[model samples]
Target: MTQQPEKEAIITVENLEYAYCDFKAVDGIGLTVKKGEVFSFLGPNGAGKSTVINALITLLSLQKGKATVAGYDVSRDPQKVRESIGIVFQEITLDRDMTVWEILEFHGKLYSMPRNERRIRIEELLDLVQLRNKRDIRTKYLSGGMKRRLEIARGLMTRLKVLFLDEPTIGLDPQTRMRMWDYIRKVNKEGTTIFLTTHYMDEADMLSDQISIIDNGRIIITGTNWQLKNTLGQDIIYLETSDNIAAIQLLRTLPSVKDATKKFRGILVSVHKDGTKVLPKIIERLRENGISIDTVNLKKPSMDDVFVYYTGKEIRDDPPGKNGTLTHRPGGS
Candidate 1:
């Protein structure tokens, strides 16, 4: 047997921490994002997702611990880290008065890109983001989606290895969000590592190759979507019956059933393999035991289900400004 080589980490953090006054915004969290991977930090508002990103990108000073981006130490080589990565903040930072072309051209110039090369790269990125037709239009005139696409284009102005997108599609419609996802996929396919943070479960589920669920300034869980869901281990069988307690005990003893528990008024069983195959036997056994089942359902776990399972609550977009700097309220995990 041969051991495979480990994938190189493009972004690495070790016990990273940041604080404001007495509040520890990012509490000793650490993660690694592999080269060309779409790594997402999924959490509610003010879960310290943004703070961690800020630290990684060298925007916020690291109060403690260490981080490296694109092989450059964040603290020692902030400029190198900045040059190696691009950032799209939660707030739009585009110049509304400038044309899309002008904005990109300016960014390219700021990076000291040669004129001819800048022109060619701008054209390529404009087409890549599907905004060639809107290139001459002022940014203020472009729709939210177009502006976002332009921001993405601008982020790619430099030859970057990593791109950080903070809540990239928070306000877009479903169609537009899908379009953004397509663009993001295309970028990732072309080999730019994407590091994004979003509270949207579906967005994380669809876009991320690796996901870390952060809550109340701490990482509650981290894994691929399937890996995270598989931690629950087996499909959930829900039964609303005449006697929940008796049904739980009976279901738990079955070889095909992994575990069974009482959920509210229903008996929730974790079925070992094919839930459909086990359903008939469950029903038969319950009937034989004189247990009357009123309703039955077998469900595969979703990322949202997994999120609630780990964090003990669903993701919520708490309004900004209500709680000063940190907006998310701490919940049981």
Candidate 2:
């Protein structure tokens, strides 16, 4: 018998593009999300991550290239795309006046879910998000984390095949953030493909099976966490076993060495590039100085280093509030 070809990816975009005013928001970007995989679209602010997701959600038109989700053209069949996907945005959208149970019931009814099924769905979601205890409490009384869990549970009301979680744990406490991560994993295990965007490097490092690093509307890198980090924050150690000290002066001439600081018995070498690859030659130089090696250390940069390498900026450097007011940026990290 002939072998059957593998199925098409769950989502595909060909030269997909969009712009805002004079600044291009999404510049000929291309990506694919596989069935049942957690694919992350990661980038710093002003990098067009939000704009691309908005286009997929049908809030913006597809001005160039084609985008298809679950075999439905995003532009031509928006309703079908919407039905097949669930979205949990960065912003929390809920009425403070209503209790948790009311909002979930109302959300189900909006989709024309049958009364009996709506009840079953509500019970399941409440338990799924661990909110059964808060079902009757006003949403306003819940903490930041609780509200986020509610949003996740509410998204499941539609029984979606794909989930878009945009910075799902943005401003919650560390403990709360971990809780949200658990909830995300639980949902994924139940058979949902997820498209996640996040600024928390640690979260992205731990969660995404595959990640695309986007910068200023273009994808600059794509790989699993280990592979990608290897490209950026490489381990490089500074060494100077030379007591001759004159030889250390010659080592400073190398362009890759950023700064060489003299410590008690050795030097702490920082590099603009990987120093491990330069280790052998460095050892030879020390031997020429009649120096013998006693110690060497290797230190790799963190995910923060990877981010700066791509965008040339730090995520936390951005002003956290608008008009210098907290009210304008509630729950924003």
Candidate 3:
């Protein structure tokens, strides 16, 4: 019988650590991303998401540990690692004066692509990103979403094995963000592994095959969305009642309910079984106890809930520094 070969990791980090002056930005972080998987580093502004990404992509020097990208050691073979990966930064980097075509053409040229092959790849990428119609238009004239799409296309010019996107859809409108996700999915389907960082819970839940939640420069948890949500072990049923205190006490007695508590303006009940099935019973029980419900909602455990459960705070509450600037370790450090 022939034995199957073990799959190799496309990206790997072990005991990685980095600091800014006396302040550590990343602490003993370690992870592995398999080939062709969408691996998300989910965190808020200064949680060292970018620092980890930078170190892996050779933007920052490894301070205390080992990391490899596309079979090349990040510290020893920075150029080889860079050649195997592409990056789309959080901030826009396009030249306003250049047309979308010009920008992509310049990138291909920098990689020393053959003119004919470069032209073919440029057209292919433009179509992939749905920017073929805007190819000749100046980048500055394009909408924020369009510019983002163009950046993604440019990032693909090198035939990268891994693509690093730092908050790819951060500032786009919801509809635009969704459209961008579609494009990203298309790219992923064609076999480039995606490594992204974002604070948006829904985005991470929707896009990632695997997720690692980082907080205060440390990884709090790592799992698939479903696995992480399952860790909560109960479904949440929230309802506003005429007598929230009474409802909470009544819910605690139900066989299906594991716990009950007052949250915000409602009573939050944790049920051992499916919340949807148990919801009607909960309503009926409340009515039997003479507690009138004003509004009721049942929510499956979401990535947002998982983040809060682990970090003890919402991701949005991670504020910037005193001057409203993000405090990140210098990339070269």
Highest TM-score model number: 3
User: lDDT of each model, Cα atoms only?
Assistant: 0.82, 0.75, 0.82
Model 1, CA-based lDDT: 0.82
Q: Candidate 1 or 2, higher lDDT?
A: 1
TM-score order of candidates, top first: 3, 1, 2
lDDT of 1 by residue, 1-333 (tens): 999878899999999888899988899898999999999987766678889999998889899999999999999999999878877777778899999999999999887899999999999888867889988899999876677777767876776799998877766667767877887888788899999987677898999999998877889899999998787656878789998888888888899987776655676576768888899999999999999999999998778667766665565544431221222122223
2 versus 3: better TM-score goes to: 3
- Assess candidate 1 and give its TM-score to the true structure: 0.79
Write model 3 residue lDDT over 136-181, tens digit each, in one string.
9999899876787787678777667999988777666677678778
The TM-scores of all predictions, comma-separated, are 0.79, 0.74, 0.80
Q: Count the backbone clashes (under 3 Å) in each candidate.
A: 0, 0, 0
Off by over 4 Å in 2: 1-7, 112-117, 128-130, 233-298, 317-333
Report the CA-based lDDT of candidate 3 relative to the real structure.
0.82
10 residues in a row with least lDDT, candidate 1: 321-330
Better of 1 and 3 by TM-score: 3
